[model samples]
Target: MSGLSREKLLGMYQKMVEIRLFEEKVFELYGQNMVPGTIHLYAGEEAVAVGVCSALRKDDYITSTHRGHGHCIAKGADLNRTMAEILGKKDGYCKGKGGSMHIADFNIGMLGATAVVGAGLPIAVGAGLSAKLRKTDQIAVCFFGEGASNQGTFHESLNMSSAWKLPVIFICENNLYAMGTRQSRIMNVENVADRGTGYGIPGVVADGNDVLSVFRVTDEAVGKARNGEGPSLIECKTYRRRGHSRADPAKYRPKQEVEDWLLRDPIKRFKEHLIQEGTLKEAELLATEKETALRIEDAVKFAMESPYPTPEEALEDVYG
Candidate 1:
């Protein structure tokens, strides 16, 4: 909200709402046995994706985690195609093969989402290196959870990117739990960003729930990366409202913790902020919500109406 134009602020709000609604709809469809496979919903962490992507250009690259619908939507992927992919329809981004865990739209610079925990780090590093080699200022963003931070790929990618001054931004969506295990139990450090010191890059932390806060930090990081300042480790302290995946009930988490995080729901908080600052009226916000919901519904309709891939189609895109 700080010095942002009215249009940008509204656009951010719309994106956050879109992500939230899309995830919620996916949850509903999955419950109805309409969606195939498991889904990692991005309900509570909408701000992180919208905020970071808002700071990036359309051509700027991003690699996402298994929980990546928010990332795809934020990066400007078409709603119909993304929904179709989740529904396993032929019109999907990956032609229905990738499903929920592996949607990619290169036109929007959404390189892809991989299920492997820390795999995106190296891929993002590769993208940054490509940009550097081509003498372009494009930067790459890698989105991973706290659990992946402990992976070898994390440290190795950071070290390599730092040494080469590749334009990369490593974003750690620390929602406190790596699946069911809490961050405190797995790692000694309180903040994941602290690890940046070891890699010789700036380490920063931001409120993942606060869209403006996230945008500010990411914007600054983007500036640094584009100016050839190398990579940065950004740890956004946030929480996932739902269980780890569709099968997880998240009983491992304390009931009180769930209640507290629900109270801090990113979408609700941003809505209140926008209203309090007079940036948007209540009716306008409601209208945006309604419009977004309708858009998501249309995407679902599109996906439902789409045909599934034929049996032999899977062998078409296969590679060694």
Candidate 2:
């Protein structure tokens, strides 16, 4: 809010709201048996997706993880299609097959999300390489969790991106826990950004809960990538407010820790910041919330009215 334009800040605020409300709807719908399959909610980490995507162009590509709804929305995917996808309706982006974990909207630059841990890393690297070869200024971003940093693909992709000076940014959303395992329990490094040094790329850290802070760092990285300066590792330190997946209860997390992070809720903080800065009034924030809720309600209605993919269509999109 300090250096950013009013429009930019407002856009970021709206996106954070959309993600939060969308995920909340998904959680509610899933509980009511309105949606099928498991979902990894992106409630608390809305700032990361909004901030990073704010730094990208329409043509730039992004790869997302299983917890990907935030990424899809921030990158300009249609809310209706995304919601329909989670509901497994025929109107979904993947025609109900990909469900919650594999929603992709290539028209909006989202390559796709993979459920397998760390699988998106190499895919993002490949997209970067293709962009470089095609002589396009388009850059690629990969969003992975702290847990994926330990995977072999992380090292391999980072090393390869640095060696070739590919236009890619490796973003690690370090929400403290990788699924049920805490970061400290599995990794020796204090910061995931430190892993960037091994690949000869600049490693940067930002507060994943702070949208402005994330935008600042990612804007710099995207600028460098556009200028052919190569890849950078950005580690966003944040916390997830829910369990790794639905029905898990997240009892593994400390009650105090959850309460502490909830106090730092990115959407609430951003709304307050907007009001304090006079960019948006308290009443306007409330109105926005109401509007967002209605929009998501419409999405749910649309998904409910839509049909499901027929059995014959199962192998239609499948490729060997």
Candidate 3:
């Protein structure tokens, strides 16, 4: 895929598989009431996070949406910590405080995920400004849904980043539905990226179901931003295999739509591609799957065994 090294391609596959398994396990745990708080599963959209983060340097900043587990894993955050965080164990990245929607690891340049609809946009814009002021080649990326596009923060951040030529990439994971609302019912614009034209920045779309396609498009955007070309709007058309959040049921979605997206499952498609290209044997792919299952099991065990944060910790890390 795009002449990427065998290692990198396999790594991408592993990350996607890891996220899928992690989320699947989380889903099961939630059903069992083992996980606290509601969860927004990233099961269907693994390709977007893996593909884009693969193009990013470790030092580059990324702001995540409520559904951010995939982003954290793709950005090299410790899976054990992430899983622990989801389980609300003290061993978690946030000491069991952040839960599933707010996992953040600043060391990896993951600013954190906010459950608020469009809040991360301005934070990412600020990070981009910081990079520009520091005169570094580092860039900031903000991941949001099509629903957030309507927020004033989105427009304002894009305008500011464009005006200042800030090194930021605005990625819209247009998964068709914002919660239960389909994009067509909410926004008039057919393509979200087209809105970027008003800000005088490059607007592009990629196949979110294809990891390689996402990587190729994001690489171009990251390169442009690093070269001081300002912000870009990259819309990755995707679909979420699950409902908006836990217990959503998503009765509004049509059977055919769900079926169509199932056929485009990113992880399955990537595995098939790797085998067809002779890059990996079926056994090798199965081995990766087995390894991922074991890893997830270990993470779950670690989370289950870890203690919860002390009550006093609730008072820490708080602002008046």
Most lDDT-accurate candidate: 1
Model 2 pairs whose backbones collide: none
Task: Single out the weakest 10-residue window by summed lDDT for candidate 3.
Answer: 1-10
Measured on C-alpha atoms, candidate 3 has an lDDT of 0.94
Alpha-carbon runs more than 4 Å astray in model 1: none
Which stretches in model 2 have alpha-carbon errors above 4 Å? none
Better of 1 and 2 by lDDT: 1
- True lDDT of residue 19, candidate 3: 93
Each prediction's TM-score versus the true structure: 0.99, 0.98, 0.99
The 0-to-1 C-alpha lDDT of every candidate, in the order given, reads 0.95, 0.92, 0.94
lDDT of 3 at 254: 98
TM-score of 3: 0.99
Candidate 3 local lDDT, 198-250, one digit each (tens): 89988999999999999999999999999998899999999998999988999
- Give one digit per residue, the lDDT tens place, for model 1 in 139-248: 99999999999999999999999999999999999999999899999899999999999989899999999999999999999999999988988999899989999889
Ranking 2 against 3 by TM-score, winner: 3
- Candidate 2, residue 242: the lDDT equals 89
Lowest summed-lDDT stretch of 10 residues in model 2? 1-10
